[model samples]
Target: MKTYDEKHIRNIVLLGAAKSGKTTLCETMLFEAGIISRRGTVEEGNTVSDYHDVEHERGSSVYATCLHTEWRDYKINIIDTPGLEDFIGEIISSIRVCDTALLLLNAQHGVEVGTEQIWDYVDKYQKPTILAVNQLDTEQANFSRTVEEARRVFGSAVTVMQYPVDQGPGFNSVIDLLKMTMYRFPENGGKPEKLPIPDSEKEQAERLHNELVEKAAENDDTLMEQYFEKGSLDEDEMRQGLKIGMLKHHVFPVFCLSALHNMGSGRLMGFIDNVAPAAIDMPAEQAEDGSPIPCDPSASPVLFVFKTLQEPHIGRLSFFKVLAGEIKAGVELYSEKGNTVERLNQLFITDGRNRHPAEVLRAGDIGCTLKLKNTLTNHTLLADKQSGKQVKPIGFPTPKVRVAIEATNKADDEKLSEVLAELHMEDPTLEIEYNRELKQVILHGQGDLHLALTKWRLLNIYKMHVEFLPAKIPYRETIRKHAAATYRHKKQSGGAGQFGEVFITIEPYYDGMPPYREHPVRETEEIALNWGGKLVFNNCIVGGAIEARFLPSILKGVMEKMQEGPLTGSYVRDIRVSVYDGKMHPVDSNDISFKIAGMMAFRDAFHQAAPQLLEPVFDIDITAADTMAGDVMSELQSRRSIITGMDSQNGYQVIKARTPQAELDKLYAALRNVTQGKAKIKAVFAEYAPVPPELQKKLSEEYKGAELVA
Candidate 1:
């Protein structure tokens, strides 16, 4: 409830796999700082961070939550993020706005697939990080083995700054390796007591301390010289050097803590204040124009909206990070994407769903405000109109599953579009689109639960009720070989007579045609028809057989036919129709006559040639425990996934495969079951491939059944 200066601020993000005690660690940190009188457990659904209704029901974090605490004259703004792959976007957004990431690992599980999954994001951002081996009070806790696992997974750069005094049953205290001091906790409650390292583990602690000292010495020439000359460096100099290495990500300090029991929390807090880097110390964000802007408190205003939420009472709330300069309430800012200017009615720092009014926001600080027009997630706000620059947004993973939504009430259909648009603006990862050919409103997200949750939020928060079912996959039908056909359109209405004849050859479009070679006539309006593998029309009517004036009408007709496939009523693609010969009456052969003739000729030729349907495929990445790898592989095989390769990482297995999108629409829960909730997978749309003969028969049967019902 108090404002602090930049130097006194420590922006930290809690990141790890699900059930890794991130929420518990956040509660522990807050309680220890005396910010809260007592700690709240996840099981009780009373934690300050995981406060969402859905999070409470599931007993896991579903969205990123922000909170601040004062510890030892420092303001630590902690952002706790979801650990499941479905909500990984929340984790990335949180990391982007923080100075350091506190990666939590379950002591019993050691390093998990989720830990390995998020490490890549941290590495990509080059953000400084500290490892906390949590759940140390659990029955199977092993501090030494977890440290070794971290080293093996994260390389030798991971060094232990503190070690637990005991394992599993006897876990009570930690020894600060850098300061050569042991801090033991009270059996009941209160501050830790200073004590000497036990004789049994003194030698092992000394060896680990030497390794940390050597790593610190490598950071500076003077420190290395001191170590070489006296075989040891001064404690103060070593601490300073270690901080430098850790901030640069050359060294990642590992600390042991039982966040549930409040053990080792004090020492963890000490390491954060003494080691974590400030926002100004890290690199500043750049604009889309590739110009690096300094994160000075007085620089030009540049803010990025990292998250958005649809609240029942507040309407829409947007959370943003000020990349440069100070932003005050009621200031006018320009949106680079919208090319429109808007003012901040009021500004606030957000904690969970709660918003606290703040007068101004400085660089490197994250905050939010009420309704702003033309501003959405991933949009950049600028101080003035002249800068005309925007900050590049972080990349969000693509949705893996799609579900079609239908309005519950017939009158709600029109309103559904507007509501879905607002919801999509709130969560960029939730994609909504109207597939014209399929006549369905498609909603896509990370998985079935993600899609279902989106629909739930739309109804609950936005007051739009809808029904969800499997989305219709847009399959393409095309001919395999060249075939020629002819058709004639004739109509007689009173005095006017309509007559037209079209003779065309249909062929498949070849891939990889040079851009210059395509549409040599209309260079400005050249389309990538070949790239989409769609139908193409070429007019080569010599001696004016069809007349140049009728070309447009004929092309229009061919497009109409492409929408209505020759066999299964699916959209047609990858074919070329050549209007080489045709006859038309100048007065009677209008657009309608040519259109009818073109459609008939194209369809006849398509059916004569070998027609086939194309289905969507996805590239999948699966990360699971070594014990579950075999079961996961078998499951993938059952889903018709073709394993491309396999590898082991930190005692876990990673399987890369490709499978039909339809087969993977509901695999999230099955994967969780097979891996015992230890597996995480990410999937993206690859390309459409031909359906196998047996499966094609099944799909054809379904297509026919859908037609009969229609």
Candidate 2:
């Protein structure tokens, strides 16, 4: 392989819905570029991108695979991404580093739910995009309907660059609208001979070509003036105008493709090399301080890792893009993330699982290295430590599903944590947390399929047996009103005696509430609970009824009871405790005696204070196809969800509601079934609300108390 300058490198990410032929398109691109001797099909499980065992099992891409091709004078770096929205993490991470997104559309299905979901990210990032209508040879291919649907969803920016002359089983040619010619392919479809537009299609081709010319000229004043003067744009002028339009996100050129037949890939690659914005053409990457770091091979060296992978026997592979300067084999880089100085012993240009060793990679180029000690995804490595430069990392999406997982063999529990940690590093969306309050190891991910894939890898690849369990919700306990109770602790041992008495008034705590009026307050400590809300501890002791030194022990006892709530052994929050009076024996009243008396008094008052249980509530937004809107709504209502808003977006229904955290799992399953897996969902934490009386009673009864139950 050879190194390409920043301007000569073109990085593109293939994106679309499942079975939209993203992997096929990648393989076809490699074949067209002469990088591969033969093309591999997704059905044969030999495609470069979907090379993972899980992907082969599912017959789709589960992880984003990096591949490269050298065509003409440019080195095009390709990142083929998974199409399933469940693997959105791969798509997002790929999008974060790519210069352009080549989005494929299955010809039979015009605009799918997956396309709409991915469009949100592409639009958010404003990456230059080229939409390709693939599978033109399929029997049900409808190019016109697909174009109209794309225009409806993506607005007027969709400009057609080429159209299939005849779609369906016998499709063999496309009219190049921009070049004003026809490309007739041979039976096998590698290179096509350029021919003049036939008279039968001239009228329709001329009309579409005029639209393309105007769309291209609308981007720049110079091109618009030239179009107005000459009533047209030359081939070079049109390419320049379209490039500007693409960089501004004003135009998305559409092309016709049949990746399975190996048609239209060469044309698409030609357009990419000629017009698509390279990394240097797009906005420069920002440093930690929000300053742009331009791509320059001669500048100080810097690289940003966007993805990482762990090969079973072969250590780890970190894929990164050089943002400034160049990186060579055997170069040492400093990672500020963990302050580890890593040596890049080997540099390779990756093609699926295959790695081609390269001596050097210039700026704006994507490459991989092996055996980085501490660097992982989103970590930035620099050549100089005193440079004080750390590139900003990509913000990964939040997990939608939560489940408790443990090793099937109890002995592998510690090893399980270590493996999960490593998995989380490679894929940021897979989050793991050991919740002390619940005493469970929780795994959070995109959905059931996402978590199941993780489990499969843990079993097959890591040889660690694990099982998924139901995760528990973090419910809170609080009181509603004020109540007073007094308790005495007296323990008479053979050698010594312990005696103490405490009187405490417990009430619900809220912000901006006045101090206790039952007794003159001497001191107060407003402590915030670790779970949620606050705990107000008031010391109203006066006239030396209780020693000041003993007050600390009393507060400590109150905290222990709050940690394990008096109602259901959950964390108690938002409460006020005022210790007004207590009796302490001069000889026997020690810290232990006062602590026990204080805990018992708080518990006695809590029972009389009308305790309530609060459960987590989430603001959930669900996007489903139009036909499944009613069914989706009905399913939500069944879970006692309150519908907040409903609207339409790009031919889909957007439903917003507030639902209990306990119902999320069931709701997701129901939505998947009713919508046939076409719904997109996102959930965010909202304020906690009290559970129903029956549910509260059931939960309280189910909780097995440890010490203070009797």
Candidate 3:
């Protein structure tokens, strides 16, 4: 790989919604730059960026792929990111390392939900962005409609840098408004043909050109005055005005292209080369101490590891973006995470799956290092001790859904955690959690597909067969009334017999109120609530009803009964049990005897008291486009959700409600379908609420029905 000067390098990211032809755009750029012999299609699954087997099988990118291309004396390092909202982490990482985000919009689809999502990210990062209307050769391509949608959704800051001469099947050329000439592509894959603007599109092109000039003029008073007075400006003046607007985020130049057909690609390349900002123009990342490291090429090294790939034989491959200074092979850098100094080996510049050797990678360049110790994604690497500051990690969306997984084979059980740990390192959005109580390992991610990919990687790469199951809801049992009880244990199995006596009561507990019984209780009070009634125990055993050494065993027995609730067999809660009176034999009354006595006494008391099963409720935040607000509200109502309130979020209507967790098992897909793929919802486990009588009965019956299956 040949290194280019800092000024000549343009770190760009191609980000958009799924199936927006982002991969095709990268392929076209590579082909146009003479890097590829022919363009690869997504249908054929031979694209350079979507080289991964999972991506080809799914027909969408799962991870960001880095590709470098030379266009018109400028080096454009393009990072093609996955467009699915579930895989949005890739987009965030790619956008953070790039100076410009080329948001590719399918001309036919116009502004999609994923487009809105990426736009939000760009707005948050305050990065310079350009809109490229792709698929101009498609039958349904509408450039004007797409441009209008961009202006409507993204605001008036979006301006046209070039106007398409014709759209759809006739899209063979585009007229550069700034240069005032037409460039048409010939059938052969070679340089485009320059020609005069056709009379047919002259009026529309002129109107768009004037609008662009007006937008650029607003950024500068001199340019505005010149544009208004003379009705035109020279190339230098226009470029200056556009640059000011783009840097200030006032102008997002829109370009037209057919990435699949290789039409209008050269023109788009020229625009990126001339208009895209360099590292100097982008915002300099600051450390936690609020000090900015001059992002200049000569400044000290400050690199961020945005990605980590675990290769089978070669170990870990850490990819990072250099924000300041040039980095050479065998350089020592301080790792902020580990708080230790580490040395880099040979640097690898990436192009799809291929890695080219580079002696030194300059600032604003993205490269990989092989086998870095203790380096993980989102870790920072600083040059020396003085400027040892870390760049904050880019924010990613939290995983909303989870699935409990176990090894399908007993042999793979021990290696499951180890394999999942490596997968989690590769994708930070994935979370692996172990529920000790349930004895289940749960994997959490953005959606089902995200979890599926994680499992796929585990089985294919790590050779681990895993079984996926729905995570069990942690439920508890509590009581409503109070009652008292007593029990005695006597076992003569052999020479050492077991003898112990326990007296306790079960009672319902209120959070801030006194016990339900409100009776003057004795020292030993065991209160158990089964089916909503409380059992209270009072034993005034003067001397030694229970042995002092067996108190732990008595409590252990009581806890065992609590877990095996009286009514529903669920874990019991809010019940107070006290050991006030008991009897014991000197040698026979051991921990075992006391434990058995305590367990029996608690169970007996709990059954006497009433206990009930409590189900978990979740607070849901549903945000949908205005078009689907009514449908979402209706769906929530169907799920028996309590409507809390509603509001607006970034043009989408947000509905906050509370619903049962059981109703949300397969709701991810249902919500997507109802909202036409524009709604986003998040639900968190809230406080437990009592199930209705009828619903509780129905659920109990269903549980019994499932018992037959088991």
Candidate 2 whole-model C-alpha lDDT, 0 to 1: 0.92
Write one digit per residue (lDDT tens) for candidate 2, span 1-710: 88789899999999999989999989999988888898888889888888889989999999999999988899999999988777898999899899999999999998787888899899989999999999999999999999999998888899999999999999999999989989988889989999999999999999999999999999999999999999999999999999999999999999999998889999899899999999989988999899888987899999999999999778899999999999889999999996899999999999988999999899999999998989999899999899879898888889888899999999999999999999998889999999999889999988899999999999999999998999998899999999999999999977679998999999999999986899999999999888989999999999998999999999999999998887678899999999999998988999999999999999999999999999999999998878889999999999979999998876778999999999998788789899878898888999889998999988887774434456
User: What TM-score would you give candidate 3 relative to the actual structure?
Assistant: 0.90
Pairs in steric clash, model 2? none
Give the Cα lDDT of each candidate: 0.80, 0.92, 0.80
In order of appearance, the predictions have TM-scores of: 0.90, 0.97, 0.90
> Where does model 1 exceed 4 Å of error?
353-356, 493-497, 509-531, 534-551, 578-589, 618-633, 641-658, 666-672, 677-686, 697-709
Error of 1 at 173 (Å): 1.9
Q: Give the CA lDDT, 0 to 100, for residue 208 in model 2.
A: 96
Misplaced by over 4 Å in model 2 are: 647-652, 705-710
- Please give, for residues 532-623, the per-residue lDDT of candidate 3 as tens digits: 33433333334655545677687778777876555445567776766667777878778888888889888787767765567788898888
Candidate number achieving the greatest lDDT relative to the actual structure: 2
* Candidate 1 lDDT over residue span 1-710, tens digit each: 46655566678989998888999888888888887788889999998898877788788988888886678987778899988777777888888888898999898988887787788889888888899998877899888889888888888888888888776777778888987888777774347888888898799889989999999999888889989999988778787778788777888988877787787777777777767877777777777778876777778888888888766666777788777788889999999787788789898876566567888777777788888878888898888779877887888877766788998898988888888898778767888888887889898787666776676677666677788877887777776777888999999978888888998887777665432222222211122443256555677677766777777787778878777776667777777667778897877887788888988888888878877788888889898878788898898999988999998766668899998877886676688887766777878789988877787677778777988899
Q: Give the Å error, residue 223, model 3.
A: 4.9
